[model samples]
Target: MEELLKTLNNIRSLRLLAKEIPLEQLETILKKFELVVQERKEEEEAQQLVLAAHQEKIEKYKELLKSEGISPEELLEVMNLHRFNPSQHKKRAPRPAKYKYTDLDGSQKTWTGQGRTPKAIQIQLDKGVTLESFEI
Candidate 1:
């Protein structure tokens, strides 16, 4: 009962708020909302057509497999048997030393060729030093 009362109050509040809004502004807002709804409907229809076409293609392929005595379950089992390890799907980190160069003090600096340039490398770069000069 309390929930129903709260919902009724919310509706009344919205109606009062709507009455306060200018008629011309409300009409314009409604037109824009209607346009959005129309566009959404069109997009959904296009997607439905695309989904139907793909479903048709899938049915044809299934029929072809049936004619060849191959079931979808068998195909799935064969694929599952040769599935790659989970670790193989992970992205590998770049090696820390793709390029190495010596500073004026004879200390070494290395870059992985990723992310921001280190201060040591940036100074050389600002001087127009070629990146190839630092190649490993």
Candidate 2:
């Protein structure tokens, strides 16, 4: 691709510098360019046909749903209810607490010891208290 682009650039520079290209060579280049344009047009038309077919199928399904008294919104809601959304997974049961302590406010609290150290535990630890001392 890079070499093709370089060749094209060289041809462009030559065209700019030359007084005229020979008629036969110019005709040959024009024919190749026209073939490329025709191929592109055919590919575009094929894509349009595929898109039109897909749209037609969608419209037909919509009409069928309407005939059966189901609105598009209802269909979408039903689909969402059955969809396997990652966030909708059943939550794991809470981990059992591993430590118990009393807060500054005199309320009991427990920790699974998986997250940040609780303020009550932190204060005791700051005073050289061992974490195992609070384990349940």
Candidate 3:
């Protein structure tokens, strides 16, 4: 890997290696490199086409906004007003416990009944006990 990296990084090393390689093997390597280059060029051209399409749409929107007597800056300000502000939003408070039960180790535990049932509660539930029996 290191030798490959050194050869790639140094033009002199690359030229020397290329000169030593058999013509047939060199032709095969060249063909593969050319294919890779063509693929990359096609990918770049596709991306450029997408960017051009986006630009065209943006221009059309700008013209529509102008016809409606609204400047881009004004539209941006209105959009910003409705945009979410994490600092201004408060996190919701945690839900209160809905059920209380004794664990297998004889310790009291509480659950909000939101997610998976506790193993201790599940064991009793499997034995025909009602889930409501553990209600807080």
Clashes of each: 0, 0, 0
Report the lDDT tens digits of candidate 1 across residue range 2-85.
Answer: 875664469786577678889998789889979999999999999999999999999999999999999999999999878997
lDDT of 1 at 6: 69
Error in Å for residue 111 of model 1: 26
State the displacement of the C-alpha of residue 41, model 2, in Å, after optimal TM-score superposition: 0.5
Candidate 3 lDDT over 26-46, as tens digits, reads: 899989989999999999999
Q: After superposition, how far is residue 129 of candidate 1 from its true place, in Å?
A: 38
Worst 10-residue lDDT window, candidate 3: 2-11
Q: Per-residue lDDT for 1-136 in model 2, tens only?
A: 9876765669676575344777788788889989999999999999999999999999999999999999999989999999899897899999999999999899999999998999989999999999999999
Which candidate number would show the highest TM-score if scored against the true structure?
3
TM-score of each: 0.51, 0.53, 0.59
RMSD vs true structure, all candidates: 8.8, 7.1, 5.5
Q: How well does candidate 3 match the true structure in TM-score terms? A: 0.59
Sort the predicted structures by TM-score, highest score first: 3, 2, 1
Clashing pairs in 3: none
